[model samples]
Target: MTSTPPTRRREWLAPAGLIALSLVPVLSGAARLTQLSTGATITADNARFFDSPVPIVVHIVGSSVFLVLGALQFAPSLRRRRWHRIAGRVVAPAGLLAALSALWMTIFYEMPASVTGPGLSALRIVLATVMAGAIVAAFLAIRRGDVRTHSAWMTRAYAIGLGAGTQVLTFVPYTLAFGAPGPVLHTVLMAAGWGINLLVAEIVIRRRARAMSARRGRPAPASVVSAPLS
Candidate 1:
């Protein structure tokens, strides 16, 4: 029996972590709208901006849809010309809708009114824009038969969209270890989530670049040579 490759083992870890993290919100029985700062509870009345359930629902549904579709993109069987084109048509619009919904929800719901409010909102806006641009570019690259570029951009977009899940995962450990209050802990976890996603994107880009370079450098398969007159 053959052992699993180290790369396969490593690849399994992220998806496993994502699966566990995705279930946390549901398991905790916390209101999806609740925002915690440090250990202290800030009442919904105090953070009136997030009181709307519509935006929260939109964000949750949009992100979840993106995550599920993004996972399907890794299916090797879908790499065929026909399936890839069909999937591209579906993914492009779905990704656009998800990014737009997340962006609008972020603006209308969760933004704070303090100094950091504008900054954080701006960051979310920028991230959403990046996600949208990456998705669009990925689609265009696929149309042009540029698979390498398409894969890279799509990975970047997916990474950013998945950042939310990573944030929740990081928060649990940090909150327990530091004993930080809810608000501060939430902020720290959000930052950590984006940071990790960016780091992952960079690592992926570098690896893909190296792989592409190696493929280009490899010599074409030579014809098998046999002894002529032995």
Candidate 2:
């Protein structure tokens, strides 16, 4: 029997990992949508979502498409084909939809203060806006034929969009160790989730830049990368 080459196998690892992480939020979003559609029991936590269903529906569906399809874009082999361009057409709009809907929810949703304190709401508004802006920047870059800039911006947007998945990771360990976090701790944990994703995205962007530069026998570009949104 033949086996896949290690180098070939390694190329798929990143996208696979991203898809795995994305599944957490995707599944949770699915459950939320199901609850909304089925008219599940209204609780303090979910009442806001039920009342304002449009934004949440848009956000969930859009993010699901963006995350799943966007992951495939990271696969080098897949990107080498026409599939990448076709997928990007859908992925870009989906990402914008997700980000903009999130911004709407953050601004308009009336959640219990205990669940979503002012600080957390403010953070969401800022991050959601940033995510939307990043997607726009990515689209503009690609239109100008600046592939590197487009990739970097898309990476930043994807990182911010996936913050909810990262939050599950952040909250799981803390919740397991201690009971449910209070407002301050909850805000800190949420920030940590976005912070971690952005830091990793920056590292990936710089590494890719260096690799591309090296391929052309040039020094790596200076790191004047723009800041992450979420």
Candidate 3:
């Protein structure tokens, strides 16, 4: 058989990579739900979730759905189709559930002092709020027929939601090298994970804006370039 064209191959690569990145956390979340449902023995690490299972359950399921479906949206093939709009209807609510549940857990779940200190807790709350707000802003933008603004907001929301996957990637090598991080290190690494994802999101947003401008034979306007985070 003949090989696929390089351009076509590259187009699919991004969505494929996004799906791969999402697998670990999504699988882990499923396992957690399984454990909770099966009444697995509670440990220090899992006691908080066990005590108040609803929020964690909602978070795991919602985020899992959001990540997988959201990944498909990144595919240029899907973006050009009608299903992108249909999927957005589901994706928006799923994303809101994920972000709002996370905010609830961060604020109400009594996590162990060793696991979450003030700084990490604050970081989580802020990010969850931002994620939820981004989703809402994207929905509103779409309602107003602002496609670029909608895409930018949704991209930022997806980046934040994908932070869980990035955290796993960041923590694996770190735990191996440092033998399990302390609270301070844990917070720092968590910040780094989310920060890295957001930074990448910004770059993608800017590049897309530039590409659209190039197609129109004009410079990317400042609003399009910087509106994602702002």
> Each candidate's lDDT (Cα)?
0.62, 0.88, 0.89
Tell me the number of clashing residue pairs for each predicted model: 10, 0, 0
Deviation from native of the Cα of residue 176 in model 1, angstroms: 0.8
- Candidate 1, 1-230: lDDT as tens digits: 99988876766565555555545433332344344323345564435333455655555555665666556555444454477566667666767777887688666664443313224666777888888888887777778877777777777787787776777668668767776545544555676788797777767666656666687995322111110100
Candidate 1: Cα lDDT at 180: 54
Superposed Cα deviation of residue 170, candidate 1 (Å): 2.1
Writing each residue's lDDT as its tens digit, candidate 3 over 54-162 gives: 9988888889889999999998878989999999988999999999999998888778867774499889988999999999989998899977778889999999999
The model with the greater lDDT, 1 or 2, is 2
C-alpha lDDT (0 to 100) for residue 195 of candidate 3:
98
Per-residue lDDT of 33-57 in model 2, one digit per residue for the tens? Answer: 9999899999988998877799999
Residue-level error in angstroms, candidate 1, position 1: 13
Clashing pairs in 2: none
By TM-score rank, best first, the candidates go 3, 2, 1
Error of 2 at 118 (Å): 4.8
Which is better, 1 or 2, measured by TM-score? 2
Off by over 4 Å in 2: 220-230
